[model samples]
Target chain A: MVSGIREMKRLPVGIQTAGWFDEKDPAKSFRFARECGFESVDYNIDTIIRIGRDEAGNSYSFMDKTDEDLLQYYEPFKAAAEVNNIKISQIHAHYPTYVVGDEERNAYHIKVMERILFVSRFLECPAVVIHPTKTPDRGQEREINLTMCRNMIPAALKYNVMICIENSLKRINKNVVQAIWTDVEEINWYIDTLNAEAGKEVFGFCLDTGHSHIVGRDVEMLIEDLGSRLKVLHIHDNNGTEDEHLIPYTQNPGNKGMGQIGWDGVIKALRKMNYEGALSFECARGVKLLPEGARREGMELISAIGRYFRKAIIEG
Target chain B: MKEKLLVGIGSKELLPESNLEDNLRMLKECGFESVIYSIKENDLKMQANRHVYFGAFFKAAKNAGIAISQIHFKYDEEIKECNDYIESLHNALHICNTLKCPFLVIDPIQLKDSVQEKEINLKIYRSLTPVAKKYDIKICLINTIKCAGGYHQHAIQGACADAAEAVWYIDTLNVEAGEEIFGFCLDTGCANVTARDMERFIITLGSRLKCVHISDNNGISDDHLMPYTQTLGQVDWQGFIAGLNRIGYEGALTFDVSRSIHTFPEEVRPHAMKVIAAVGKCMRKSIEAES
Candidate 1:
């Protein structure tokens, strides 16, 4: 076994095979990741909240959700991280509708993020990420967005968790249409405007690889412009049109993974920027679990990319 | 190992005094090829490595030769962090894959508090389907009613507060999406109130009938006792098991007598497993005779 390029030493590089981080697999997905030798992962907050509840007791979800009146379920995550030797580098919180919209829930959201921050700090994670929604059509959606965000900034300030907003990728979902304003130009404008208005670096964008692909944004180009300002990346591959979040360096049916945008170049750009966070496994491919010594192809793919990062990018 | 049917006794079954491996060995000896394993809401983190608590159970299962067929994630975790849960699912799926178990059962997370945030729920179903498909493990949602306590009396409300609507909604979404990834675990006790149809629900669920959690309750409430205990709700136990037969449900029928076995704490769990194993034989004979 040619030991992974020695220079690849602790690049803080991670992959998103949920198995290594989680117990989520067909018994096969884990085998693929482990056999391949990648040991980091990211997960959905919902799984943490609903995994073991009776019916009426599950009032807690990861997203700062509606009517935030319930108990918190953060221990599962703390325990899961410890088991896998995986650290939660970023929270990847869902839309904080309750926090941004309601003041009380806003306080709760901050407290929750702060709590996650305590864990993230232990994990040495740098950020807590989320997706953005268009404001409800009250008087001013922008105001609601800003007002809700205004409360959110303090939470980020208190916790060491940098709050980042991600673009929604449900191009076909009519329901999300109202809360959608993720055109790249509109996003850059949103970032600049929000910061200028707040006069603080309170929030940033999470580059959702699939969403950007859906919008036909060149991954490399987005990296170049958004690099320094951006706070996170929801990394995964997809067929060009639909957001079928697939593993990276591989192409989906209709579109080459990353579409016309070159995967190699995108990685090169991200490497150039020295993005030290997670290349979160936001998609699914074939996965498995096994009795033992299981093989994980996804981990192999991630390891391959890690090698590329170490060899051509880091060395170069 | 043939994919045997089983149901979780609830992860809260993990008592401090419980000998994880001892009970697991008993589970294997009793011929339980499947299990609906769970973790407490607070213990969801520790449940992952499984080795922590079940290191013995896992090793024993391997040694005595049994398969962990199903998973009942009975704890509460964040849905938005589904990305992380997917990771956990990967591990759960790993167990299923390890045993070649066919199905994995879970509770549908209601992140959005109301019947209103249907879209978020839909997003969740859609999001996890890919992983479900990738793992080749059948993922199902279990409906349940919490036995609430008060100064006046007691009751069992459907799992997740109005799960019937949500399960119907999300299942429709997944089915419409042509994704067979979402299904129901169909707890005998939980179905008392939340199940859409006692007979038709199981029959229609057909192959989607992954696992059936067998428990009983008084007509007044869900007691989760052994069969012949409850006469409540709309479920026909004999017919429901028949429904499992009708739907061709080949998964485990986990006998969750957790409350009953709580004191013994893994001691009599296998004895209970033996009783359930007998029940499994009846089920197999009944189904095979019918077919």
Candidate 2:
């Protein structure tokens, strides 16, 4: 019941798993998101794509089950999204596609991802997030990242899921350094090159607010830079240091001295770009760390903040 | 092995209202032989001349019987500009030199890409090598837990979370610098959360194990509780002591145990300091027995 400005261009407010939803119980989390007034939810696909190896060293396939069984597996997620009237924003895929010396593991993972794509498509989720490749050597970074998408492009096309490459940051020597796909220039190049080669919009960019904050990237400027190509968002706030993933403003507990990310500026840029995607809050960890009794209230407050931002974007 | 147990406490425990000399006196009175100093953001920001301020702070520590074993440059999260970051790092090195502290512990910020992480970390650390060498202080990169939220969002742990990565980072830095300039600080809480076996990690780091943050947790979030407080899901103390002995670690057994003590009522911290001193003594005894 977190009602705000009623307008045709009102961007729908969304929420992530937010640590309240146990992976085993998707219904409870989605229902909570719905009750909190979130119009959409970014489903964490990591729980579904569990990759394990047997004694024979062959990868155990979750997809090897009967189609009926697969339907049963997806029943909870589908029912929750339907009953709560929540749209599935995107399935955040397992990151670092190139595990060091684990080609079999990566291959097994891609197979699982292919199955998730089918489930995502069925749920009408438009996008899925896969991280850019991380290698020890910088020279092979671009090629490795492209190859990952190249291999999965056909599956993505078949399932009609747009793979969104998220911006990421690494902690190096106590300084937040930009990783692959963090730079706007690199992201533009990667997205442009990938989509051009695929002959369609198979890959796009996911702007992670916390990742941008930690590396000192201006979220508003980045949004403006990405413009129409930015398909998704992983919105969260941090106090300029460690990815604390706190709520947008410095309103939450335990954020006395932390830096506040500028949400108004962010909304201004999104409004300028006429962003049509979900305004999802990836700020779940901040609330999850609260005492159990405070969680529901904390979640409501976060949802209210989301509505506030949505209202800001619409009013502007 | 030295017959006397050498122990220290994080200077973060010292209230900002209180000056260094009074805190050092209190530490000396509490039986802490050494102190691990921390340079707060405010301390650097408020002071017009930081070098002079640090010099005076070190003078006060020397006046007391407390030796500064390590200086922690409080992690600056707002440093987005490279020039600002370098300036802060230089200030850290300057503080270390002023205090004549042997080790400076830091939590490196994570980059998105691993290659960029290695390249950027190497470049930054390499730039600081001369300052470290000139001051005769070793730079120790500490391990970190997952950023804000656990695993879902990609918050890169520092370039040295894994044992092999730590070795490679330190070895490569040292080899390039043509001197043993860098080392690793293992945080017990971080190790537990990351599922890193402390014994094996110690064995891997060997001589590169420069400093340590000793605290207990439930192996989920970083609780930073007093040792043995969390009886369940505690770190393998037996293995921890054994590994230190195996590596012939002769560094100070500093208690990064702050949350537990800091959370205590202000009036009760004095007694808590004594308890920390006793815990440090007991751990040293156990480590010595293993040796």
Candidate 3:
């Protein structure tokens, strides 16, 4: 007898750990995520670093730990992922990579990122999402981010982790406007330039659906432009005017079909590109706003939505 | 256009029943310029001293400097068979007049039989028109969705779920009344549940659209989640704002996200209200800017 059913490709669905789960307890966090129907997680390593000043005006962070100690500190997260059968698909580096005119702070951010890349390798994560710097001058913004990425090249190459540059937004005059890497051409240029500098494909793009929507960038077109260079995703929704980081499809005002993001077009574009990355949710606000007891239900709903997207992408 | 589109919230979840004055003050502090006074059946049935009860509520709202944008009249299933339901509606209209609210949003009577559904709702709305007109209030029919098996089940089209049918209901009622008395309250969450394209619905309704119950949801259920806070792409907020802009909507941007608000801890509810008001302000700005 011959079986008639063909096997289907199952895409890994993931969620971020910053606001949804207790990151201090990696064992519980990974287990809870797996229980909530997630197969992967975008480890929010940014929480480990403290960038602001203390009461004494002294900056401090977990980045003060030695390389070996930091790796040991995160060893349990790796073990927990293995035990729960969850993949650490990606790690998010601390942001604001270049604070304006603050050389010491900017240097500290670079040092933190380098250490994070090292820890990401220990966690067996494949990608690290690093945000581009924002400045009033477009040229200065490019120079700052390019230099930052260039500085991370050695660590990225050594650890074999792809540095994923995410599209960002900036508030100008109380209005959100497109910032560094929001445009397809601008992002492509950054990825291409960084990869060229590294002598390999060490750079990739992490498309943030919420950020793109806030700045009125067409998600489908952005995905199509990034194509194979897109290695990760920060899937979330917004009302097109604010970076709310909401769950998909929840932003329609007055049920008037005024949703800023076109999710169907987004899924279709991802399908067309044959994107092979986890559908990771970066909707921390969605989970954070819910009461503690209701968070698991919220995560389950988000995971179910991911399954819907996965089926649509694979079958369509 | 900018002045007309003010941000507001429903009082059902955001305000504590015991401390109406303090809560209204909090709402004012949270940047809400208007509020939809959610009237329950009991509130309407308070009978002899109804004015005494609602007068204080109105006083608190006035003191807080918040406009009573509208009144949400909660409906019971047995409304068609009960004479008390009609009386309750009259009472609500009276309260609306007392509160100086311009619009009163009510759900259409949904009978199992479609013909009866239309007949009963028309009679009910027609009966309320005398009092509505006396109070100088517009009776607004909200578009609703029916969940076939129960909650969380697939939502199908309910009364006035279609734009043409909604328009027909309003126009027929107004024509019969010999004046414009009935308008529409578009519940965006209900539209999402029934998969109605809001832009088309709003455009079709045009000037008849008077009020809105702005909320978000996954298409499967009427979750009443905050706008821009649900599963991605389930609600089309862009099209919603565009439709409002196209129609030059001048009503307050009132939010009815009670379920979403209830999901927050009691202590966190105030902060959640702030976020809701902020989202409303952002939406109001978008609509006004386009206009």
Candidate 4:
């Protein structure tokens, strides 16, 4: 309770498991995250997209796990997180959840979302990051995303967790262009509408720094616009060209004297908006590419930066 | 001429109990010498956990003295992300390498537009060719056939509907890849569903036939029934047997007929399997007599 100077809230720094590329066990990765001084972790659920499919050709995932099975499956992770004193920030749901041209398949994807909600509750997590539905009808993107939200919100409420709709960027497939909720305004619309309709904060936003950087949307503006509705963060840097989730301040290859993102600006904007969540790093790709034993140094550097930013900008 | 008939079965037949050792034992008991192995949903999770390795699975098969003639891999993801799709295929290919499986079969993805079908199929196979080469496995593309109004039609709308078109597809991939890793998996049930001339189709496959899914249909649907079922519309068994003998086809006469066998009660399945084994024995004797 120091009085004169404004003290920075000791917001926990977190890391997602996907960045621990080769590390197969979540318990081991969570231990490492704790040792590296990260206080929380964004657990990744789709590290290895195994090739086995159901009869209808849907890839099996945690969604396929029954309640008893899933509980047994992730119990070790829960124990590790508890023992390491690391908070479970959220679960990162598998991407490209939107199925095209098939009602049965779409229903399957929704079922997966419901299972994820149950998992979120099982893990005692407060939120789950869900990608917006990607479809061909750009004009109807908002409606489609809303429809998906409506479909999952009851389950979200039932599980007492929040579904954070992450903003996306344009991606092409088979010569057809699909625009997910790439625009900030549309995302704002989704959050506002969902929260308002639910009469509570049922839906929130997960600002993906890499996706925002790729689509060239202003990170600072997004914070200002989102205000308190932003519940989670996927903080990572990338070369301006691709969604390579590199560690913050890493040099972008072939781009002399320029890094992918301005971490200082992002922190400053967070301070302005007074974000309360953990400063989670989604830079596992950068971490994985390091020479075997050198990865710890990389994680240490990341944790140090997280502390530095917290003290310099957030503390002031 | 091929040495023995090498009657084969699909691993799917032993599902629900899905114990690899037990399945292999059952297949052997049923007189099956070859099998079309699939990485099912549960098996995939087991592989991820390191609890069930393909090496061990195949070793049990080897101990049972059964050969994995081909692997049926149907990827669950839509081909939206090319690299992701390629990566999934690479994992499956690695498993094939572990099992030393010689052939991998896939149902060619169907797109709405016919003109784009060839290009898409070529692009997908082209991406998979390097992995196929690395694993020393042949990629076999199966044809698309539909049954409508009691008549079978080779998919006039999808890629590689006709036998010649299938050969052309495989050849195009082979030339572009600079290797003979690409080939055709002639699904007899698909042929029957389309009412195709089995002899002509087999001749067209010629030396390019890397694997075969020898099942029967009633010309009304791809029922995956046992050969000589007679209940299904007639499969030209004589013409098909003669065509393989004529081409000197060395591949196994593998049956992807679990769908029909699975219809019977668990107790009756072994008996149904005996019937299939008898038919396979008959076919092999006939082929060997010709040789």
lDDT of 4 by residue, A57-152 (tens): 765654687899878877887888888888878778876666556566667677888887887788777788888766567666667677778888
Kept native contacts, fraction for each prediction: 0.00, 0.00, 0.12, 0.00
Worst 10 residues of 1 chain A by lDDT: A286-295
Single-chain TM-score of chain A, each candidate: 0.68, 0.90, 0.92, 0.87
How far is B54's C-alpha from truth in model 4 (Å)?
Answer: 65
Q: How do the residues B34-90 of candidate 3 rate in per-residue lDDT, one tens digit apiece?
A: 999887787565556878878988999999999999999987545544577877888
How high is each candidate's interface RMSD, in Å? 23.0, 14.9, 11.4, 30.4
Better of 1 and 3 by DockQ: 3
DockQ of 2: 0.02
lDDT of 2 by residue, B1-291 (tens): 432447878876563535768878888887688878777555676768878877877888889877888888765565467666667777888888888888888766677687887787777778888888888889998887556554433233445789898888889889988999899888887887677898999999999998888876645456676554332356776788889988988888887877656554354466556656766776787778788
Model 3 stretches with alpha carbons more than 4 Å out? A1-10, A52-59, A253-260, B1-291
lDDT of 1 by residue, B152-232 (tens): 245555433343453575468577668677666767666664444566667755665566677654344454554432212
Give per-residue lDDT, candidate 4, residue B227: 64
lDDT of 3: 0.81
Per-residue lDDT of A1-316 in model 3, one digit per residue for the tens? Answer: 0010011124689999888667678899888899988988888878767677678756568877998888788888789989998888888888777788888777777778888888877877788998888888878877888888898888888877888999888887998888878899988888888888788888888999999877777889889989888888999877666788876655543333245478788999999999878899998898765444445656776787787788889988
lDDT of 2 by residue, A65-159 (tens): 66578778888878887888888777788655666567887787677778777777777788888877776687787777777778888888887
Predicted model with the maximum lDDT: 3
